[model samples]
Target: MASEGAEYDRTRGAGDTAEATGEGGRETAAPPDPKIAAAVAAAEAAGPQHGETVRIDSWIWSVRLVKTRSLGATACRGGHVRVNGERVKPAHSVRVGDEVRLRHEGRERVVVVKRLIRKRVGAPVAAQCYID
Candidate 1:
């Protein structure tokens, strides 16, 4: 008799041990791919750690707020970007908790720095680096 919430393994016949099949007759999770593991390890190694300072333009691009680093720099130079209520240059330093405002394509994006990352990451990872 199987419990109401328990999974039943009907395939298990007499003398068939659970170890021969898997955990409770379910297959085990496969090991991570070597290439993916290496890429993740490399990203973690190169990613910004605590108490790191990153350039405003660089940070913007790294967080995926801008499509490219050059666009970020251009926006800064054109006075289309502001950090903490002050217009700053591309080389300006941006720290955690600073509010960044960028006006692009007639729209404004406001974000608060939560983590500082230097290298460009995937959109999901980039989203973790800021609070919008």
Candidate 2:
């Protein structure tokens, strides 16, 4: 019985360490993709320090509200997207605090722009750019 308990303790300790280091006992924070990094850098350079305005379609894509910029633009042109209760074109400017309503995939998603990001990013990063 003592041997079994010792084995259990070792297994639990190993599991904890594995989780800390990520799967396969390796750290997970790999370097950012070069393309993504470049895009983000360009976006940051073109806009103000923060709270800058961006095109509606670009904002939607950047926030991961749509899968792609073309899809976002299509929704805007199809009248499936509105800003502050008024229909807007894809080229319309979206600023911080603006309310956006997008109808897609048989559902409506309403979001408020909290921060503007012009480049596409991972889902976790994109989620930080808006308020639902």
Candidate 3:
């Protein structure tokens, strides 16, 4: 009886050996296209590591420039955000010494990146991330 059950388990898992063994590996992310997946992989491999890079949207919201991260992303999508004189997407990486410009509420804010931060911080702490 045990051998029969074992055989059944093997038969069921034979098609996907990796998942069956529960190895420390990841599966495909359901990317839309092979080319797109390759591009994303290349970007990730080429980009700076986590400690060296922060997403522009997160940095903006972190430094209290925007009320929320979503708003920061919206500003980027609307072309109200610029980095180093070029409009950038929300996912663009921001580094120290980069200049950031934000247009909001009938005003434009220009600040240079001093430090990279990810979390929303209090005003005092946020101020340390950029120089106005």
Which candidate comes out best when scored by TM-score?
A: 1
Against the true structure, candidate 1 has what lDDT? 0.80
The digit string of per-residue lDDT tens for model 2 on 1-132 reads: 999999999999999997876743322342245555455556556554654568999989988989999999999999999999999999999988899999999999999987777777776556656888
Q: How close is candidate 3 to the true structure, as a TM-score?
A: 0.61
- Candidate 1: tens digits of C-alpha lDDT, residues 1-132: 465324344444423665666644332342244544444455557866766688999999998889999999999999999999999999998998999999988899999998777888877667667899
Give each model's whole-structure lDDT. Answer: 0.80, 0.82, 0.80
* Candidate 3 accuracy as lDDT: 0.80
RMSD of 3: 12.8
lDDT of 1 at 26: 35
lDDT of 1 at 36: 44
* RMSD, every candidate, angstroms: 9.5, 10.3, 12.8
Off by over 4 Å in 2: 1-52
Clashing pairs in 3: none
Clashes of each: 0, 0, 0
